[model samples]
Target: MNLYPVLQTADVAASARFYRVHFGFAPTFEADWYVSLRHPLAPHAEIALLDSEHPSIPDGYRERARGTLVNIEVDDVDALATRLDAAGVPVVQALRSEAFGQRHVIVRDPGGVLVDVITEIPPSAEYVAAFAPNE
Candidate 1:
Protein backbone atom coordinates (compact mmCIF):
# COMPACT_ATOMS: atom_id res chain seq x y z
CA MET A 1 0.00 0.00 0.00
CA ASN A 2 1.12 3.51 -0.83
CA LEU A 3 0.35 6.47 1.38
CA TYR A 4 0.86 10.19 0.85
CA PRO A 5 -0.40 13.34 2.50
CA VAL A 6 -2.43 15.88 0.56
CA LEU A 7 -2.17 19.55 1.46
CA GLN A 8 -5.00 21.98 0.86
CA THR A 9 -3.85 25.41 -0.27
CA ALA A 10 -5.26 28.64 -1.63
CA ASP A 11 -3.14 28.32 -4.77
CA VAL A 12 -2.38 24.85 -6.02
CA ALA A 13 0.12 26.01 -8.64
CA ALA A 14 2.18 28.07 -6.21
CA SER A 15 2.24 25.29 -3.64
CA ALA A 16 3.26 22.86 -6.36
CA ARG A 17 6.11 25.13 -7.38
CA PHE A 18 7.31 25.38 -3.77
CA TYR A 19 7.89 21.64 -3.60
CA ARG A 20 9.27 21.45 -7.10
CA VAL A 21 11.80 24.23 -6.72
CA HIS A 22 12.96 23.75 -3.15
CA PHE A 23 12.75 20.01 -2.73
CA GLY A 24 13.30 18.73 -6.26
CA PHE A 25 9.89 17.19 -6.61
CA ALA A 26 8.32 16.88 -10.06
CA PRO A 27 4.64 16.68 -10.74
CA THR A 28 3.44 13.25 -11.71
CA PHE A 29 -0.05 14.54 -12.25
CA GLU A 30 -1.10 18.14 -12.71
CA ALA A 31 -4.50 19.77 -12.78
CA ASP A 32 -5.90 23.21 -12.07
CA TRP A 33 -7.23 22.05 -8.72
CA TYR A 34 -4.66 19.43 -7.77
CA VAL A 35 -1.11 18.28 -8.34
CA SER A 36 0.76 15.07 -7.45
CA LEU A 37 4.50 15.18 -7.06
CA ARG A 38 7.36 12.70 -6.64
CA HIS A 39 11.07 13.07 -6.23
CA PRO A 40 13.01 11.43 -9.04
CA LEU A 41 15.36 9.53 -6.74
CA ALA A 42 12.63 8.36 -4.41
CA PRO A 43 9.60 7.55 -6.48
CA HIS A 44 7.83 5.96 -3.54
CA ALA A 45 7.85 9.26 -1.71
CA GLU A 46 4.95 11.33 -2.97
CA ILE A 47 3.01 14.42 -2.00
CA ALA A 48 -0.12 16.00 -3.39
CA LEU A 49 -1.42 19.56 -3.38
CA LEU A 50 -5.06 20.46 -3.76
CA ASP A 51 -6.91 23.74 -4.08
CA SER A 52 -8.51 24.37 -0.71
CA GLU A 53 -11.66 25.68 -2.32
CA HIS A 54 -11.98 22.78 -4.74
CA PRO A 55 -15.49 21.35 -4.90
CA SER A 56 -14.44 17.77 -4.18
CA ILE A 57 -13.37 18.59 -0.63
CA PRO A 58 -16.16 18.88 1.93
CA ASP A 59 -17.02 22.53 2.57
CA GLY A 60 -16.07 22.56 6.22
CA TYR A 61 -12.76 20.79 5.56
CA ARG A 62 -11.51 23.11 2.86
CA GLU A 63 -8.86 24.79 4.99
CA ARG A 64 -5.08 24.79 4.80
CA ALA A 65 -3.17 22.31 6.90
CA ARG A 66 -2.23 23.50 10.36
CA GLY A 67 0.59 22.32 12.62
CA THR A 68 1.45 19.58 10.10
CA LEU A 69 5.04 18.71 9.40
CA VAL A 70 6.37 16.89 6.35
CA ASN A 71 9.88 15.47 6.66
CA ILE A 72 12.07 14.81 3.66
CA GLU A 73 15.38 13.00 4.22
CA VAL A 74 18.25 13.91 1.96
CA ASP A 75 21.94 13.02 1.52
CA ASP A 76 23.38 16.35 2.53
CA VAL A 77 21.23 18.76 4.48
CA ASP A 78 24.03 21.32 4.98
CA ALA A 79 24.41 21.76 1.25
CA LEU A 80 20.64 22.00 0.86
CA ALA A 81 20.60 24.61 3.61
CA THR A 82 23.05 26.68 1.65
CA ARG A 83 20.96 26.38 -1.47
CA LEU A 84 17.84 27.35 0.41
CA ASP A 85 19.61 30.40 1.81
CA ALA A 86 20.72 31.38 -1.64
CA ALA A 87 17.15 31.09 -2.88
CA GLY A 88 15.92 33.35 -0.04
CA VAL A 89 13.76 30.65 1.57
CA PRO A 90 13.43 31.27 5.27
CA VAL A 91 14.47 28.49 7.59
CA VAL A 92 12.12 28.36 10.54
CA GLN A 93 14.47 26.11 12.49
CA ALA A 94 18.11 26.77 11.87
CA LEU A 95 20.12 23.80 10.63
CA ARG A 96 21.37 21.80 13.57
CA SER A 97 22.58 18.31 14.37
CA GLU A 98 20.46 16.29 16.72
CA ALA A 99 21.47 13.66 19.22
CA PHE A 100 18.86 11.32 17.80
CA GLY A 101 20.65 10.79 14.49
CA GLN A 102 19.41 13.66 12.40
CA ARG A 103 20.78 16.87 10.97
CA HIS A 104 17.74 18.89 9.97
CA VAL A 105 16.27 22.25 9.15
CA ILE A 106 12.63 23.30 9.11
CA VAL A 107 10.86 25.63 6.72
CA ARG A 108 7.28 26.51 5.98
CA ASP A 109 5.76 25.64 2.65
CA PRO A 110 3.47 27.97 0.78
CA GLY A 111 0.41 26.44 2.41
CA GLY A 112 1.82 26.92 5.93
CA VAL A 113 2.86 23.30 6.39
CA LEU A 114 6.19 22.82 8.12
CA VAL A 115 8.67 20.99 5.94
CA ASP A 116 11.60 19.42 7.80
CA VAL A 117 14.55 18.71 5.59
CA ILE A 118 16.91 16.16 7.15
CA THR A 119 20.06 14.17 6.69
CA GLU A 120 20.84 11.15 8.85
CA ILE A 121 23.92 11.10 11.00
CA PRO A 122 25.31 8.82 13.66
CA PRO A 123 23.49 9.31 16.90
CA SER A 124 25.34 10.68 19.87
CA ALA A 125 26.70 7.97 22.15
CA GLU A 126 24.21 8.76 24.89
CA TYR A 127 21.28 8.41 22.53
CA VAL A 128 22.50 5.46 20.49
CA ALA A 129 20.87 2.83 22.67
CA ALA A 130 17.43 4.37 22.29
CA PHE A 131 17.00 3.27 18.70
CA ALA A 132 15.69 -0.18 17.86
CA PRO A 133 18.11 -2.40 16.05
CA ASN A 134 17.55 -2.85 12.33
CA GLU A 135 15.89 -6.12 11.43
Candidate 2:
Protein backbone atom coordinates (compact mmCIF):
# COMPACT_ATOMS: atom_id res chain seq x y z
CA MET A 1 0.00 0.00 0.00
CA ASN A 2 1.16 3.52 -0.70
CA LEU A 3 0.93 6.12 2.02
CA TYR A 4 0.15 9.73 1.21
CA PRO A 5 0.11 11.97 4.26
CA VAL A 6 -2.25 14.92 4.43
CA LEU A 7 -1.13 18.03 6.27
CA GLN A 8 -3.98 20.29 7.36
CA THR A 9 -2.99 23.92 7.24
CA ALA A 10 -4.43 27.34 7.79
CA ASP A 11 -3.47 28.29 4.24
CA VAL A 12 -3.41 25.49 1.73
CA ALA A 13 -1.92 27.62 -1.02
CA ALA A 14 0.85 28.94 1.15
CA SER A 15 1.76 25.49 2.38
CA ALA A 16 1.71 24.14 -1.15
CA ARG A 17 4.04 26.91 -2.20
CA PHE A 18 6.39 26.17 0.66
CA TYR A 19 6.74 22.55 -0.41
CA ARG A 20 7.09 23.49 -4.03
CA VAL A 21 9.58 26.29 -3.63
CA HIS A 22 11.77 24.65 -1.05
CA PHE A 23 11.42 20.90 -1.61
CA GLY A 24 10.90 20.58 -5.35
CA PHE A 25 7.43 19.11 -5.07
CA ALA A 26 4.89 19.63 -7.83
CA PRO A 27 1.16 19.78 -7.38
CA THR A 28 -0.54 16.82 -8.97
CA PHE A 29 -3.97 17.95 -7.81
CA GLU A 30 -5.18 21.28 -6.52
CA ALA A 31 -8.42 22.86 -5.42
CA ASP A 32 -9.82 25.60 -3.26
CA TRP A 33 -9.46 23.49 -0.14
CA TYR A 34 -6.84 20.91 -0.96
CA VAL A 35 -3.71 20.19 -3.01
CA SER A 36 -1.75 17.03 -3.68
CA LEU A 37 1.98 17.28 -4.35
CA ARG A 38 4.35 14.72 -5.78
CA HIS A 39 8.13 14.84 -5.89
CA PRO A 40 9.37 16.01 -9.26
CA LEU A 41 11.42 12.87 -9.86
CA ALA A 42 9.74 10.41 -7.55
CA PRO A 43 6.12 10.04 -8.44
CA HIS A 44 5.51 7.77 -5.49
CA ALA A 45 6.61 10.43 -3.06
CA GLU A 46 3.55 12.44 -2.25
CA ILE A 47 1.99 14.70 0.35
CA ALA A 48 -1.35 16.47 0.41
CA LEU A 49 -2.20 19.88 1.72
CA LEU A 50 -5.71 20.38 3.07
CA ASP A 51 -7.47 23.43 4.37
CA SER A 52 -8.35 23.01 8.02
CA GLU A 53 -11.98 23.67 7.20
CA HIS A 54 -12.23 20.75 4.81
CA PRO A 55 -15.30 18.70 5.70
CA SER A 56 -13.73 15.33 5.00
CA ILE A 57 -11.54 15.84 8.06
CA PRO A 58 -12.94 14.62 11.35
CA ASP A 59 -14.16 17.20 13.84
CA GLY A 60 -11.38 16.38 16.27
CA TYR A 61 -8.69 17.18 13.69
CA ARG A 62 -10.42 20.31 12.45
CA GLU A 63 -8.85 22.19 15.34
CA ARG A 64 -5.42 21.82 13.65
CA ALA A 65 -3.91 19.60 16.26
CA ARG A 66 -1.78 17.06 14.41
CA GLY A 67 0.64 14.71 16.16
CA THR A 68 2.22 13.15 13.13
CA LEU A 69 5.81 13.78 12.05
CA VAL A 70 6.55 13.74 8.33
CA ASN A 71 9.83 12.18 7.30
CA ILE A 72 11.31 13.09 3.90
CA GLU A 73 14.45 11.42 2.64
CA VAL A 74 16.64 13.49 0.39
CA ASP A 75 20.00 13.03 -1.30
CA ASP A 76 21.64 15.98 0.40
CA VAL A 77 20.38 17.10 3.75
CA ASP A 78 23.08 19.77 4.19
CA ALA A 79 22.37 21.44 0.88
CA LEU A 80 18.65 21.54 1.54
CA ALA A 81 19.25 22.82 5.04
CA THR A 82 21.42 25.61 3.65
CA ARG A 83 18.77 26.64 1.17
CA LEU A 84 16.07 26.50 3.81
CA ASP A 85 18.22 28.60 6.13
CA ALA A 86 18.65 31.18 3.40
CA ALA A 87 14.92 31.18 2.73
CA GLY A 88 14.13 31.95 6.39
CA VAL A 89 12.66 28.56 7.28
CA PRO A 90 13.15 27.82 10.96
CA VAL A 91 15.04 24.71 11.86
CA VAL A 92 13.29 22.76 14.60
CA GLN A 93 16.41 20.70 15.27
CA ALA A 94 20.00 21.18 14.22
CA LEU A 95 21.58 18.80 11.73
CA ARG A 96 23.03 15.68 13.24
CA SER A 97 24.51 12.43 11.99
CA GLU A 98 22.93 9.29 13.39
CA ALA A 99 24.70 6.03 14.19
CA PHE A 100 22.54 4.27 11.63
CA GLY A 101 24.30 6.09 8.75
CA GLN A 102 21.95 9.01 8.21
CA ARG A 103 22.33 12.77 8.39
CA HIS A 104 19.12 14.56 9.22
CA VAL A 105 17.58 17.83 10.21
CA ILE A 106 14.22 18.65 11.63
CA VAL A 107 12.21 21.58 10.39
CA ARG A 108 8.72 22.84 11.05
CA ASP A 109 6.52 23.34 8.03
CA PRO A 110 4.08 26.18 7.48
CA GLY A 111 1.35 23.87 8.81
CA GLY A 112 3.19 23.28 12.09
CA VAL A 113 4.17 19.77 11.07
CA LEU A 114 7.59 18.47 12.11
CA VAL A 115 9.51 17.25 9.07
CA ASP A 116 12.67 15.21 9.34
CA VAL A 117 14.81 15.67 6.25
CA ILE A 118 17.27 12.84 6.07
CA THR A 119 20.08 11.49 3.87
CA GLU A 120 21.77 8.15 4.21
CA ILE A 121 25.52 8.16 4.90
CA PRO A 122 28.17 5.74 5.96
CA PRO A 123 27.31 4.17 9.29
CA SER A 124 29.72 4.10 12.19
CA ALA A 125 32.08 1.17 12.04
CA GLU A 126 30.69 -0.26 15.25
CA TYR A 127 27.15 -0.17 13.95
CA VAL A 128 28.19 -1.70 10.64
CA ALA A 129 30.02 -4.56 12.35
CA ALA A 130 27.13 -5.13 14.70
CA PHE A 131 24.77 -5.71 11.79
CA ALA A 132 27.17 -7.92 9.83
CA PRO A 133 26.00 -11.41 8.96
CA ASN A 134 27.44 -14.42 10.74
CA GLU A 135 30.22 -16.25 8.88
Candidate 3:
Protein backbone atom coordinates (compact mmCIF):
# COMPACT_ATOMS: atom_id res chain seq x y z
CA MET A 1 0.00 0.00 0.00
CA ASN A 2 1.10 3.54 -0.77
CA LEU A 3 0.99 6.36 1.77
CA TYR A 4 0.20 9.96 0.97
CA PRO A 5 0.75 12.86 3.37
CA VAL A 6 -1.58 15.79 3.13
CA LEU A 7 -0.46 19.21 4.31
CA GLN A 8 -2.69 22.11 5.17
CA THR A 9 -1.25 25.32 3.78
CA ALA A 10 -2.33 28.90 3.59
CA ASP A 11 -1.44 28.99 -0.07
CA VAL A 12 -1.90 25.83 -2.05
CA ALA A 13 -0.20 27.14 -5.22
CA ALA A 14 2.90 28.26 -3.38
CA SER A 15 3.12 25.00 -1.47
CA ALA A 16 2.71 23.03 -4.70
CA ARG A 17 5.47 25.08 -6.32
CA PHE A 18 7.77 24.32 -3.42
CA TYR A 19 7.64 20.61 -4.19
CA ARG A 20 7.62 21.02 -7.94
CA VAL A 21 10.55 23.39 -8.21
CA HIS A 22 12.71 21.69 -5.64
CA PHE A 23 11.88 17.99 -5.98
CA GLY A 24 10.30 17.77 -9.44
CA PHE A 25 6.92 16.58 -8.26
CA ALA A 26 4.13 16.94 -10.81
CA PRO A 27 0.55 17.68 -10.08
CA THR A 28 -1.69 14.67 -10.41
CA PHE A 29 -4.68 16.73 -9.40
CA GLU A 30 -5.12 20.41 -8.66
CA ALA A 31 -7.84 22.80 -7.65
CA ASP A 32 -8.21 26.16 -6.03
CA TRP A 33 -8.24 24.57 -2.60
CA TYR A 34 -6.26 21.38 -3.05
CA VAL A 35 -3.46 19.79 -5.02
CA SER A 36 -2.00 16.32 -5.26
CA LEU A 37 1.50 15.67 -6.52
CA ARG A 38 3.22 12.54 -7.75
CA HIS A 39 6.93 12.08 -7.30
CA PRO A 40 8.98 12.32 -10.46
CA LEU A 41 10.52 8.86 -10.20
CA ALA A 42 8.28 7.14 -7.68
CA PRO A 43 4.63 7.38 -8.58
CA HIS A 44 3.75 5.63 -5.36
CA ALA A 45 5.21 8.46 -3.36
CA GLU A 46 2.64 11.24 -3.30
CA ILE A 47 1.83 14.43 -1.41
CA ALA A 48 -1.26 16.54 -1.15
CA LEU A 49 -1.63 20.23 -0.31
CA LEU A 50 -4.92 21.56 0.93
CA ASP A 51 -6.08 25.04 1.72
CA SER A 52 -6.08 25.54 5.45
CA GLU A 53 -9.32 27.42 5.25
CA HIS A 54 -11.05 25.04 2.92
CA PRO A 55 -14.33 23.60 4.00
CA SER A 56 -13.10 20.07 3.54
CA ILE A 57 -10.69 20.47 6.42
CA PRO A 58 -12.06 19.36 9.78
CA ASP A 59 -13.43 22.13 11.92
CA GLY A 60 -10.77 23.77 14.12
CA TYR A 61 -8.01 22.27 11.97
CA ARG A 62 -7.68 25.60 10.27
CA GLU A 63 -6.99 27.23 13.59
CA ARG A 64 -4.02 25.06 14.41
CA ALA A 65 -0.54 25.25 12.93
CA ARG A 66 1.02 22.38 11.05
CA GLY A 67 3.89 20.93 13.00
CA THR A 68 4.55 17.70 11.13
CA LEU A 69 7.31 16.82 8.74
CA VAL A 70 7.38 15.18 5.35
CA ASN A 71 10.36 13.01 4.48
CA ILE A 72 11.31 12.47 0.86
CA GLU A 73 13.84 9.87 -0.18
CA VAL A 74 15.61 10.66 -3.41
CA ASP A 75 18.54 9.25 -5.36
CA ASP A 76 20.91 12.23 -4.93
CA VAL A 77 20.64 14.37 -1.84
CA ASP A 78 23.49 16.76 -2.61
CA ALA A 79 22.32 17.40 -6.15
CA LEU A 80 18.82 18.12 -4.99
CA ALA A 81 20.14 20.39 -2.24
CA THR A 82 22.15 22.34 -4.77
CA ARG A 83 19.14 22.81 -6.98
CA LEU A 84 17.09 23.98 -4.04
CA ASP A 85 19.77 26.41 -2.97
CA ALA A 86 19.96 27.81 -6.47
CA ALA A 87 16.23 28.33 -6.42
CA GLY A 88 16.51 30.35 -3.18
CA VAL A 89 14.85 27.79 -0.95
CA PRO A 90 15.86 28.20 2.66
CA VAL A 91 17.52 25.20 4.28
CA VAL A 92 16.58 24.61 7.88
CA GLN A 93 19.25 21.92 8.31
CA ALA A 94 22.45 21.74 6.32
CA LEU A 95 23.22 18.70 4.23
CA ARG A 96 24.98 16.10 6.30
CA SER A 97 25.89 12.44 6.05
CA GLU A 98 24.78 10.12 8.80
CA ALA A 99 26.29 6.92 10.20
CA PHE A 100 23.13 5.13 9.11
CA GLY A 101 24.15 5.52 5.43
CA GLN A 102 22.03 8.46 4.52
CA ARG A 103 22.92 11.93 3.19
CA HIS A 104 20.12 14.35 3.88
CA VAL A 105 19.04 17.97 4.22
CA ILE A 106 16.09 19.59 5.91
CA VAL A 107 14.15 22.47 4.42
CA ARG A 108 10.83 24.07 5.12
CA ASP A 109 8.30 24.11 2.35
CA PRO A 110 6.18 27.21 1.74
CA GLY A 111 3.48 25.59 3.83
CA GLY A 112 5.81 25.58 6.84
CA VAL A 113 6.19 21.81 6.82
CA LEU A 114 9.67 20.46 7.34
CA VAL A 115 10.79 18.24 4.48
CA ASP A 116 13.74 15.95 4.85
CA VAL A 117 15.35 15.25 1.49
CA ILE A 118 17.55 12.19 1.73
CA THR A 119 19.52 9.67 -0.29
CA GLU A 120 21.36 6.51 0.67
CA ILE A 121 25.13 6.45 0.65
CA PRO A 122 27.82 3.95 1.52
CA PRO A 123 28.04 3.49 5.26
CA SER A 124 31.29 4.13 7.09
CA ALA A 125 33.50 1.11 7.58
CA GLU A 126 33.25 1.55 11.34
CA TYR A 127 29.50 1.62 11.15
CA VAL A 128 29.44 -1.50 9.01
CA ALA A 129 31.89 -3.27 11.28
CA ALA A 130 29.85 -2.41 14.35
CA PHE A 131 26.81 -4.05 12.83
CA ALA A 132 28.66 -6.95 11.25
CA PRO A 133 27.75 -10.43 12.48
CA ASN A 134 30.30 -11.88 14.88
CA GLU A 135 32.96 -13.73 13.01
Candidate 4:
Protein backbone atom coordinates (compact mmCIF):
# COMPACT_ATOMS: atom_id res chain seq x y z
CA MET A 1 0.00 0.00 0.00
CA ASN A 2 1.13 3.51 -0.70
CA LEU A 3 0.68 6.01 2.10
CA TYR A 4 1.34 9.74 2.04
CA PRO A 5 0.22 12.75 4.00
CA VAL A 6 -1.97 15.48 2.61
CA LEU A 7 -1.62 18.67 4.61
CA GLN A 8 -4.45 21.13 4.73
CA THR A 9 -3.05 24.62 4.77
CA ALA A 10 -4.27 28.16 4.24
CA ASP A 11 -1.68 28.79 1.54
CA VAL A 12 -0.95 25.70 -0.58
CA ALA A 13 1.77 27.36 -2.68
CA ALA A 14 3.74 28.56 0.31
CA SER A 15 3.48 25.15 1.97
CA ALA A 16 4.69 23.46 -1.20
CA ARG A 17 7.67 25.80 -1.43
CA PHE A 18 8.63 25.15 2.17
CA TYR A 19 8.90 21.39 1.58
CA ARG A 20 10.73 21.94 -1.70
CA VAL A 21 13.32 24.22 -0.16
CA HIS A 22 13.89 22.47 3.14
CA PHE A 23 13.26 18.82 2.32
CA GLY A 24 14.41 18.43 -1.29
CA PHE A 25 10.93 17.76 -2.58
CA ALA A 26 10.01 18.66 -6.17
CA PRO A 27 6.52 19.40 -7.26
CA THR A 28 4.90 16.69 -9.38
CA PHE A 29 1.62 18.55 -9.58
CA GLU A 30 0.60 22.10 -8.76
CA ALA A 31 -2.59 24.11 -8.61
CA ASP A 32 -3.78 27.14 -6.69
CA TRP A 33 -5.57 24.87 -4.20
CA TYR A 34 -3.31 21.85 -4.21
CA VAL A 35 0.19 20.56 -4.84
CA SER A 36 1.88 17.16 -4.84
CA LEU A 37 5.60 16.79 -4.19
CA ARG A 38 8.05 13.91 -4.41
CA HIS A 39 11.70 13.51 -3.60
CA PRO A 40 13.80 13.21 -6.77
CA LEU A 41 15.89 10.34 -5.40
CA ALA A 42 13.03 8.70 -3.53
CA PRO A 43 9.84 8.87 -5.47
CA HIS A 44 8.02 6.81 -2.84
CA ALA A 45 8.48 9.68 -0.44
CA GLU A 46 5.61 12.00 -1.22
CA ILE A 47 3.57 14.76 0.37
CA ALA A 48 0.57 16.71 -0.79
CA LEU A 49 -0.70 20.15 0.15
CA LEU A 50 -4.33 21.15 -0.12
CA ASP A 51 -6.35 24.26 0.60
CA SER A 52 -7.91 23.91 4.03
CA GLU A 53 -11.22 25.10 2.70
CA HIS A 54 -11.33 22.92 -0.39
CA PRO A 55 -14.84 21.80 -1.17
CA SER A 56 -13.90 18.15 -1.52
CA ILE A 57 -12.91 17.86 2.12
CA PRO A 58 -15.77 17.31 4.51
CA ASP A 59 -16.46 20.52 6.40
CA GLY A 60 -15.84 18.99 9.82
CA TYR A 61 -12.50 17.52 8.80
CA ARG A 62 -11.17 20.44 6.75
CA GLU A 63 -9.41 22.16 9.63
CA ARG A 64 -5.61 22.34 9.68
CA ALA A 65 -3.86 19.41 11.31
CA ARG A 66 -2.94 19.57 14.99
CA GLY A 67 -0.93 17.31 17.27
CA THR A 68 0.62 15.65 14.24
CA LEU A 69 4.32 15.00 13.81
CA VAL A 70 5.79 13.84 10.49
CA ASN A 71 9.12 12.04 10.58
CA ILE A 72 11.46 12.17 7.60
CA GLU A 73 14.52 9.94 7.74
CA VAL A 74 17.70 11.37 6.25
CA ASP A 75 21.32 10.36 5.88
CA ASP A 76 22.69 13.19 8.00
CA VAL A 77 20.62 14.96 10.58
CA ASP A 78 23.50 17.12 11.85
CA ALA A 79 24.29 18.57 8.45
CA LEU A 80 20.63 19.23 7.72
CA ALA A 81 20.27 20.89 11.10
CA THR A 82 23.19 23.19 10.36
CA ARG A 83 21.81 24.09 6.95
CA LEU A 84 18.39 24.78 8.42
CA ASP A 85 19.92 26.97 11.10
CA ALA A 86 21.91 28.95 8.54
CA ALA A 87 18.73 29.47 6.56
CA GLY A 88 16.93 30.73 9.68
CA VAL A 89 14.49 27.84 9.93
CA PRO A 90 13.04 27.69 13.43
CA VAL A 91 14.11 24.59 15.31
CA VAL A 92 11.53 23.59 17.87
CA GLN A 93 13.83 20.87 19.18
CA ALA A 94 17.58 21.16 19.03
CA LEU A 95 19.66 18.45 17.36
CA ARG A 96 20.10 15.59 19.82
CA SER A 97 20.75 11.86 19.94
CA GLU A 98 18.10 9.65 21.45
CA ALA A 99 18.69 6.49 23.45
CA PHE A 100 16.45 4.65 21.00
CA GLY A 101 18.91 5.08 18.12
CA GLN A 102 18.07 8.33 16.45
CA ARG A 103 19.77 11.66 15.95
CA HIS A 104 17.10 14.21 15.18
CA VAL A 105 15.74 17.72 15.23
CA ILE A 106 12.21 19.02 15.08
CA VAL A 107 11.12 22.02 13.04
CA ARG A 108 7.76 23.59 12.43
CA ASP A 109 6.67 23.89 8.83
CA PRO A 110 4.89 26.99 7.56
CA GLY A 111 1.56 25.18 7.87
CA GLY A 112 2.29 24.40 11.55
CA VAL A 113 3.25 20.78 10.99
CA LEU A 114 6.05 19.41 13.14
CA VAL A 115 8.66 17.83 10.89
CA ASP A 116 11.03 15.53 12.72
CA VAL A 117 14.15 15.15 10.61
CA ILE A 118 16.17 12.10 11.68
CA THR A 119 19.13 9.83 11.10
CA GLU A 120 19.58 6.37 12.56
CA ILE A 121 22.40 5.88 15.03
CA PRO A 122 23.61 3.10 17.27
CA PRO A 123 21.28 2.57 20.18
CA SER A 124 22.44 3.40 23.66
CA ALA A 125 23.47 0.32 25.64
CA GLU A 126 20.78 0.91 28.21
CA TYR A 127 18.08 1.19 25.59
CA VAL A 128 19.16 -1.70 23.39
CA ALA A 129 17.17 -4.22 25.42
CA ALA A 130 13.96 -2.37 24.63
CA PHE A 131 14.04 -3.49 21.03
CA ALA A 132 12.24 -6.62 19.87
CA PRO A 133 14.36 -9.74 19.32
CA ASN A 134 14.40 -9.44 15.52
CA GLU A 135 15.36 -5.79 15.69
TM-score of each: 0.93, 0.86, 0.84, 0.91
Candidates in descending TM-score order:
1, 4, 2, 3
Q: In candidate 3, which residue pairs clash?
A: none
For candidate 3, give the lDDT of residue 25: 87
Residues 1-135, candidate 2, lDDT per residue (tens digit)? Answer: 888888889889988888899888999999989999999784568999889988898787685536878888898999999988889888989999999888999988888888889998988887887565749
Clashes of each: 0, 0, 0, 0
Candidate 2, residue 6: lDDT: 82
Native-vs-model 4 lDDT? 0.90
Candidate 4 residue-wise lDDT, 108-134, digit = tens? 888888999999998999989987887
Give me the runs in candidate 3 sitting further than 4 Å from their true place.
63-65, 124-135
10 residues in a row with least lDDT, candidate 1: 37-46
Which of the predicted structures, 2 or 3, would earn the higher lDDT when compared with the native? 2
Q: Could you tell which candidate, 1 or 4, scores higher by TM-score? A: 1
lDDT of the candidates, in the order given: 0.91, 0.86, 0.85, 0.90
The TM-score of predicted model 2 comes to 0.86
lDDT score, candidate 4, position 115: 94
